[model samples]
Target: MNNFVLLEYAAWGISALLGLWMLADLIYTDRTYSEEMLTSSQEGDIEDSLVIDPTQQGGQK
Candidate 1:
């Protein structure tokens, strides 16, 4: 019983450490940015032409 308890504790500690390491890795990773791909004028044009059709029903209707 004592050995089982110790093994369970060790497993819990290792799982917690791995979870923390993954969280830190996700938070500190660098995101890539590209400036030459999209300009302000293009962005505005895209926003203006975008439309949503809410009245379209699925196969049920």
Candidate 2:
């Protein structure tokens, strides 16, 4: 019973440390998004152009 309790405590501690590390990384990371990066030719609808046929070559049988 004591061993199980210790293991559970250790697991919780590790999980908390990992969560804090991820939170810190997210807070410190610099991410930028710009509209100028996209070109006119890259702004087309893809769903209307994609064709899916399972019986076609390179597709699942």
Best by lDDT: 2
Which residue pairs collide in model 2, if any? none
Off by over 4 Å in 1: 30-61
lDDT by residue (1-61, candidate 2, tens digit) is 6999999999999999999999887665523433453332344465644343435537655
TM-scores of the candidates in the order shown? 0.47, 0.47
Maximum-TM-score candidate = 2
Q: For residues 5-58, write the lDDT of model 1, one tens digit per residue.
A: 999999999999999999887666533333453232343444453332334433
Task: Estimate candidate 1's alpha-carbon lDDT, on a 0 to 1 scale.
Answer: 0.62
Worst 10 contiguous positions by lDDT, candidate 2:
31-40
**How accurate locally, in lDDT, is each candidate?**
0.62, 0.66
